[model samples]
Target: MDTQQNTALTRALAEVPGPLPARGVIHIVIPHTDRFTVVGNHLAQHPGLSTTAVGFAVRIQSLPQGTEIGVKALAARFPEGEKLIAAALRELEAIGYLQRARTRLPDGRIVTRTVFCNQPSALLRLPKAAPHQPATPQAPAPAPTPRPVPALPFPLQPIPELEPTLQPVQVLTTAPQSVPAPAPKPEPLPPLATTPECAPAPPPQQPAAPRFVPLVPPPTAPKLPPRPLPQPCELTPELHRAATALLADLRRHTPEFTLTEVDIQQLAPAVAAWLEREARPDTIRHVLTNDPPQPLRHPAKLLRHRLTVLLPPPLPGAHDLAVPVRRVTVTPFQTCDGCERAFRSSMPGRCRDCRTDHAQAAA
Candidate 1:
C-alpha cells in the first residue's frame, strides 16, 4: 500500500532470474515453486510490462485460503485486469487461465459460480532486471529548518522631526471673445407635388475657365422585369377531392358541429384544405397524436430472439400433485397501432393503412 512496498515489489520482480523475452506475442510461464507465484499478463494491459496481469493473478493463486476467490475480485486487484477486466479476461482466456471445464444453465436459468476459465487469467510473472546491472539507488531525506529569534519586547523606536509649509498670492485681468461667420447655405426644398415652382433663378457669376467638355452616357445591359407573387386559395384537383371525401365522412358521423378542433378524424382533411387554399402548410403540431416522436425501430435492424424449452415455467400444483396434467407456457403478444389491439406479429412497424394515410396527411 505504501510507496516503499510498491518499490520493493517492483525491484523484486526486476531482480528475479529469467530468460530473455522474444519479440511480439511473448508467452511466458512462471513456475509456482511456492515462495512467489508467477503472474502472466497481456502485453496490452501492461503495455511496457515484462510480466502481465494474468501473471499477477497466478501469483495470488499461491495464497492457500483465497485460491477459490471469485474471478471478479481477482480481476479487480491484478494489474492486467485492473485497467480493463473485460479485455484482461479475453487475453487471459486466450493464454490459458482456465483449467476447469465451463458449463452453462438452460435458457432462463441462473448461472453458477464454479468457473474454470475457458480463457485463462493473466498469470503472475517475475519482474525482470537488466542483465548485470548495478543495484538501484535509495532516495535521501530532507533537512529541517531552524527557528527565528524574537523581536525586542517593549521600547518604542525614536520619532523623526518634521519640515516647513509655503504661502499663496493672486492677481486680476479681463477679456471676451467673438466667433467667425459661417458660409452661405442652400435653401431646403419641399416635395415635388406639394411645393409651388419659383420663377427660374438667375445663374450665379462664375470663375474663368479655358475649355468646355461634352457629356456622354455610360454602357449597361437591359434589365429583366420582376415576376409577380402567387396568392392564396390555389388548389390542385387531387387535394380538393381528398378534402371533400374527409368532410363527407364527418357529416355522416355528426349532424351538428363546429370545425374548430383537429384530431385524426378532423385534422387530416382540414390540413389538406389548408394546404390547397394556401401555399404554406398549417403547423404540423396541430395534428394531435400521442405517438412517440422517435423512429419505432432501430433503423434496418431485425429482432433475433431465441426460443428455448429451458425458458418455460412448470405447471402449478402438478409438480406435487398425484394427478397428471398438461403444462401451458404463455408469452405476451405485441400489438397493432391502427386497432389498439394485440396481434401475433408487428412486422410492418405500424398499422397497414398508416403508411398511405400519413404520407397524404403530411403532404
Candidate 2:
C-alpha cells in the first residue's frame, strides 16, 4: 500500500510545476489556536544556536508558568538524556533566552527558578544604528552591447543604432565664505627684574634605620592538660566483690587482659566509679576484654585507662522520666496548579485530592 501511494505521489508531483524536492525544505504551515508559541525569527533561524537549543527554547516558551522544565524532568519526558538537555539549556542561557536563579527556602532547601524570554533583544540592548548620510549622485551606467542573432533560412534586415540623448548638466554653486578678522598689534614687553623670586627647598629627609625581623617561629597554642581520671567512689563490700570478680573474669574472654590479684585490688576502685555512674556489667566487660592490644603489657594499666576514658555520666533528673522524640517532615511545600492551594509534595503539580478528582473526571 505504501509503495503504491509513493508511486502515485511521484506521478502527480512530476506533472505539477513546482520547486524540486532536493532543492530545499518545503514548509506546510498550520495555524494553532489552542496551544501555540510565538518564536522570533532571530532564535528560530539563529546561526549560532544548535537545533536542540532552539527546540528547547520553543518548548520552554510554550509551557505555562510554574511548569517544571528542569533537566531531569525534561529528560524523563523526552528521548534526550539529561546531559544533552543540560547542554541545550546552557546554550539558551548563554544567548539570554533562558535564566536560572537559585533561591533558598525557609526550610533550608535550595531550589532553582527558571525564567524564559521569547525575545532576548527586548531584555538585552542592541547595537545603535549608524547615522544617516546623504547619498552622492552617480553617473548613469552604459548599456551592454546586443548579442548577434543566429542566421535563419530566410534573409534578415540589418538593425540601425539609436543615438544617445543629451542631458542638461546642473552646475553646483559654492557657498560664500565669511571675511577674516585682522590680527591685533603686539604689546611691548615689561622690563625684567634684577632679582628672581624663588620657592624654599623642602627639608632633607633622614634615612630610616634598617630594622631586622627576627626569624622566630609562629606562637603555638598552649597544650591542653590531659583529662583527669575518674575519682574512685567510697569502697563498699558488695562493690569490691563485684569489681574484683569482673577484673578476674576478663582473662576468660581475652587472655591478653589477664590481671593479677594485686592489680585487681588496685583497679577495683576505678571499676566501682564506673558502677556508681550506672554503667552495666556487660558494657564494662565488653569495653575491657572485647579487643585488647597485641603482646599485652600492663593489663591493669590498660583496664584503668579504659575505665577512666569510657566512663558514662550519671542520669539527669528522675530515671523513670521519658523524653519525647521530635519528628520533622522534610517534604517541600508545593502550590497546586489546579486548586491553587499549598500542599506538601516531593514534586510540583496538583494536590492529592485535585489529582484524584482530575483522574476520576478523565476516566
Candidate 3:
C-alpha cells in the first residue's frame, strides 16, 4: 500500500508547476563519528554549560570548515542574545572544545583565529619540536676573579691633651644656728582616795559591757550554663535528608554521575528556598523525573534551573501577616504637658525642654 502511494507522489512531482533552480541548492555531509564526540565529550559533561551553549555548539558544528563566525552573527541566527552566545563561546573555549589565537600580520594588523576540536584527544597534542641547527665554534671566555681589599696595619689612636694645674677660689659659708631643746612634759596627778569627805564618794560606776553580734553570710545564686549556638538551616537533618534524596534521584537518572557532600551543601540553599515557597518533595521529584524539553547533559545544572524557575509563590500565613506594621503619627505642633509650651512631636507628650527640666528637678 505504501509503494502505490509513493508511485502516485512521484508521478505528481514529475508534472511541476514551476521551474526549480539547480544552482541554488548545495549539499554538505557531517560525519556520524564526529557527531558522537560533540554530543558525548568531556565538554558536554560540564555542569556550567546551559542548553543555549549546547545549541550554540551544535550550530557551530553544522558550519562549514574554516568558516568565520562572530558572536553577534550567531546570536542573530539563534534565539539566545549576544551575551549568552559570548558566554557559550567562553565555556566551549574553557572545556577545550574551542581555542582562539591572535596573530600579528606583516601589515601591522592583528587577526584572531578560532580552532574547534571535536575529539578530546586532539586537545592534548604536544606542540611540534623546532628544527635543530649545527653549533658554531668559539673561544671560551676567562672566568672573573675577586681581589681582596688591603687593611690598615694598626688601628689609629686618638691623642689626649695634657691637664693644667689651677688655683682654687676661696668660698664663704654662713654659720649654722643651734636649735633650742623642747620643754619636758608635766607629771600626771595622783589618783583620788575613796573617802567619805570626797562628796560622800560617788557610787561605783558599773563596767560598760561589750555587745555580742552574730555574723550571717549572704546567699549565693547558682550559675547557669551558656546556650548553644544555632546551626545553619542547610545543616539541619531535614534538609540533609532532602539533599540526599535529591542526589539519589539524580543518580537514578544518570548512573555514571556522582555528587559529593560539598555539591549537596552548595545546592542546599536552593532546596531550602523551594521548600520555603511551599514546594513539596514529591512535586520536585516529579519535575525532575519528567522528560525535559531539551537534552540535559548536566543533571545538576538542569535541577538547579528547574528549582529556581519553577518555584511556587509564597503562601499566605499567620507568620507573614504577623509582622508588626510601623505606625507613623504626624503632628504639626504639640504643647508640653508640664509647662504648657507649644512644641513639635509625632505623638502628644511632654516637650524635650520640659522633660529635661523635670529630670533635673528630680535629680
Best-performing candidate as measured by TM-score = 2
State the displacement of the C-alpha of residue 20, model 1, in Å, after optimal TM-score superposition: 14
Candidate 3 regions with alpha-carbon error over 4 angstroms: 1-40, 125-363
Sliding window of 10 residues with minimal summed lDDT for model 2: 161-170
Q: Candidate 3: which pairs clash?
A: none
CA lDDT scores, all candidates in order? 0.39, 0.71, 0.59
Each candidate's number of clashing pairs is: 28, 0, 0
Q: What residue runs in model 2 are displaced by over 4 Å at the alpha carbon?
A: 1-22, 105-109, 125-363
- Shift of residue 102 alpha carbon in model 3, Å: 2.4
Model 3 per-residue lDDT tens digits across residues 136-230? 22223432332322222454233222112111111222333432333343222211221113334345545443221112221354665533322
- Residue lDDT tens for model 1, 52-78: 544544544555653544457766555
> Which of 1 and 2 is the better model by lDDT?
2
Worst ten-residue run, lDDT, model 1? 299-308
Clashes counted in candidate 3 amount to 0
Per residue, candidate 2 scores C-alpha lDDT tens digits across 70-173 of 99999988899899999999888777777778999999999988777787665435444433332322223432342323223443333222222111111232
The TM-score, computed over Cα atoms with residue i paired to residue i, of candidate 1 is: 0.18
